[model samples]
Target: MKKVTVYLSENTYDVLNNLSSKRKESMSLIARKILEKGLTEEAAKDGIDAVTDAVRRAMRDILKPTEDRLAKLAAKAAVAAATAMYLNTQCIADLGKNNALELYQIARTKAVAYLREKDEEA
Candidate 1:
């Protein structure tokens, strides 16, 4: 074991001295026990933090591919929706106003149903 020196405030020293006399132990022994207990608690806390960090890192690693896949799926959905909208506009232009409105309602219903099915699957 290595020797270490530490300074204590007057109140702290007095408390330790009182405890030492009451316990019939030297102040050095009491201080040593206190220091050991404190160091042990600190080490345990550090160990817990390290484990928590490792678990977090592992979770992030595990989720990264899923996150990327979801991002790609979202991008694809956006592009597909944009394309469908453009096509719908063109079709409405070609068809008459009344016919276009009816067709739009049908398309909207189908799109809503499709979205519901996808949401359920998710």
Candidate 2:
């Protein structure tokens, strides 16, 4: 065993002395027991913190690719919609008013159907 010295305030020493007398143990023994219990509790708390950190890291690792894929999908959808709008505008300019109106309605219906299908799949 190793020996070490510790300084305690008057009130703390008095409390330890009282506890030692009540337990019929030496003050050194009482102090050692209390210190061991405190260390054990601290170690358990550290273990729990380590486990929580590990779980958080694992969840981030697992979800990162999915989050990236969703972002890319959103960007792709925006680009497709913009392209469709530009093409629809060109069609209206090239075709006459009546034909342009009919083409617009058909394009809009197709877009709506595509969105509905995607929503259903989700």
Candidate with maximal TM-score: 1
Pairs in steric clash, model 1:
none
Please give, for residues 4-116, the per-residue lDDT of candidate 2 as tens digits.
89999999999999999899999999999999999999999999999999999999999999999999999999999889887887778676666776677788899888867
lDDT over C-alpha atoms for residue 24 of model 1: 100
Stretches of model 1 off by over 4 angstroms after superposition: 98-122
Worst 10 residues of 2 by lDDT: 113-122
Q: Cα miss at 112, model 2 (Å)?
A: 16
Error of 1 at 2 (Å): 3.5
TM-score of each candidate? 0.73, 0.64
Stretches off by above 4 angstroms in model 2 are 85-122
In order, candidate lDDTs are 0.91, 0.90
